[model samples]
Target chain A: MVRLITHNLLACHVKGCTTNNFPLVFQDVQVELQVAEFNPDFIRNMLSRLEWTALVNAAKQVGDTSLPPEQPDMMDDELLQKLHHVLMEIHVTDGAMVCQNCNHIYPISNGIPNMLLAEHEIG
Target chain B: MIPTPDLSHLTRHDLEQVYDPAEDTFLLLDALEQEAEALRKERPLICLEVGSGSGCVSAFLGKIFGQSSSLYLCTDINKHATRCTLATGKQNKILLDPITCSLAGPLSSRLCHAVDVLLFNPPYVPTDTDEASSAQSSADIAGSWAGGIDGMEITNRLLQDVECLLSPRGRFYLVALKQNDVPSIQSRMLEDFGLTSQVVIERRAGREFLLIIRFARTAHSGSGSTS
Candidate 1:
């Protein structure tokens, strides 16, 4: 899942299952980038839903390869382009996304993340 | 460089049982093995062969890649295909160890989200009388080819389940016939999954060229239908 969308639905699957568990935050991410064409509209449309801090931090944890450390205060065309590439173009084909709080690992394979929980892990 | 396996001495029927290996297979195999070897020190390598006809490529691949201590899983919708791969492994003095040789469905939990590299050469030819005949004459009905009217019948099904088998740090190499509807697949991956993919290798075959696609991310959202 894109950090933009992974941020939306991920809640800690702990017993409480509270809203705060959301964004399950990234820790020690190892990022790999494969360049892709930029599509501005897609980024603009996705802006409202993104967890700004989470996206920025996850990008860093994965690797400081690209993307600014912080989201800009204003949405400039150039900045939006960066965000576009980060969200849509950069490839995260491989790597594990470990949740900060629950330590749940979501493995990304061939660029697809497996979010399914084990039978015992299911609430 | 890895040792090249001996691919000679098979009888005509034996070769017939072994599906035609695409020319691109060699090129992609070379490149993929290079990348895979680089990471051998870091992780136990896992490779999957999709639609592995006669499973020779997987056997060859397993022999080469597994030489330095990596795990190889050869899978095909057809059990016969995997058997063929296993047969070659037996003859080549490769994959003698139980842990190193395996054949199963793409959906098996063992493979779910656990592959390092996936090599696929699907039957993308539009369904025709020949394919139907092929399916009918097979000892096993399911393993034969039922690519639907367009020949992408199995391709779509494979794609959906493939994501689950990919390891977090894995890469996939998918081979499709030239006339196959690639745009449909790409759009599904890009728009629905929010992935960026590329045609990494191409081998021209008459009017149609076999394409090798590499998916860089999963689909975030989109319509998934078995139709």
Candidate 2:
């Protein structure tokens, strides 16, 4: 299940495939929209942990341009609601998360992404 | 006391394929409550739960740690478990990142030595090795309880990786049955990973003697020690 919250922290870990591995590109993504309860406090608290730029880029890649390019200095209710939808409501049901650096393709089937690498890919 | 996550969203049909909260889950919750003070003091940033069948444990943990302080990453081999977990988190107002993967899977390498608090209430029932393997391959409710060969087959694999997954001050809580040989497990962790452990809580439910064991780096083991 690729949520922006999980995707935000994920990077390509293919053996020595290190630098520029972050923000695995979402390709042929099949999005599932499920409405989650909106909680301003939860979204406010999550802001600090998120990589603003990476999340924004990933959101755009998945065709969700709701978030701004820059993280707002002051979080307002409206922005927090948008953040909630982007982070919690949207689920990537099926697709492949391709690494920009290593070009390793992690496929997602039935809402589960296969992050297992070949034996040689293990470091 | 932390409340159990609202599982009202899960229908009977959903529970048929997913493992519903059982005595083992409650035991883990009780152990967490016992260590609530220390856990808050540790101020963990990342918490990962393996085989998070119903997300009950992790959602309870979210309440103890508060909503915003840490990232709750939960994994279960069963796809339905992952979906149920997500819904449980939402119903409880806890944002959990539920990944459908087999016991840490792709996140292991990236999370090396980064997990602050880890939890696992694995399949600990003794069953035939072939049955366990098949259940695991099927990734259904059977995978939740069909522990192969003394119920250590799934647990042993995670034990080997615990040292690499835990941070210097990280703590791991595991639910085990008496039949699983708890003494040997504690000794092995001590010798191989230098992780000291103590039984946090124990209860006898039906035929199962449920035990919650807490493990941490030897130097920080004092935090969980009753003495």
Candidate 3:
């Protein structure tokens, strides 16, 4: 599923797309929220690795605006719950992940993102 | 022994398109099972499988973790493989997020020095360059085994990015064949990227000799990046 957690780890890999390609923009996306076993500790551990700004951008793009604009230095349970919801609960069931740099459209269907590039677009 | 992921949900049509989990897949699972305690102790947050054809290996890894906190990420060229991977993950109750991409093409940079456990059971059969290219372009079951030029064409590209993708304490488990020049692969990784490796497990699977080589950063290589 296209969770913000996984989406945070994807960028446009189109040929020569070396800059401004992070947090692939979401467009016309159908988002689903499924019950998941939330582990606050897992979110805490992943906090350091997460690109806060990119994650916030992706969350908002997916119609979620729970996270604050800037990440809090100290994470409380309330903040962690919000992080878990934004990152883990929101799944992009159908839509396209567009590259901001090269404008390459990576379609997402059935919760799977097709990141394959065309022959001409391959680097 | 760790139990294999339940893949009964996959239909015969699915197996024909996706690479079926065979001896090679089982061997990879066994290797991971052997390292269960060590892997769990590491508490790896991000685990990625480069070509998760059947999602069997990654799903098994998830099983090893029990209450897995890790994010199991997967990538494959074949669309059918991705579909099957998701099905298998769901069947096994493991959340394997798969992307339909060539190897880890789009995720390399985003995953920079973040992956803790990286597994790859690549296409290791040595085929002609054209045949391999065609198989890759077709992105079908053939692409699962057509390894161009000594079965290193596809693996070599991923090797170049491994150092950059792995975290300081990351481990990369790769399944290779005897024909792929295993010793040379080990040497190249050491000389080129300062990544030392040990053959985790090996077996004679019919006519094909399979080995799972595990690589990790050298003791002194504090950083994952080359620069």
Model 1 residue B214 lDDT score: 80
Better of 1 and 3 by lDDT: 3
The true-versus-predicted C-alpha distance at residue A86 of model 3, in Å, is 1.0
Estimate the lDDT of model 3: 0.90
How much is B56 displaced in model 2, in angstroms? 0.8
TM-score of each: 0.52, 0.79, 0.97
Candidate 1 matches the true fold with a TM-score of: 0.52
Tell the DockQ for candidate 2.
0.27
lDDT of each: 0.53, 0.85, 0.90
At residue B151, candidate 1 shows an lDDT of 66
lDDT of 1 by residue, A12-121 (tens): 45333434444555543445564544545545644553567667765555554355656666777888777755664444545665655567776654433445444355
CA lDDT of B1 in candidate 2?
63
Best to worst by TM-score, what's the order? 3, 2, 1
> How far off is model 1, as Cα RMSD?
15.4
Give the winner by lDDT: 1 or 2.
2
Interface RMSD in Å per candidate, to 1 decimal?
15.8, 4.1, 1.2
Going through the candidates in order, their DockQ values are 0.02, 0.27, 0.80
Judging by DockQ, tell me the better candidate of 1 and 2: 2
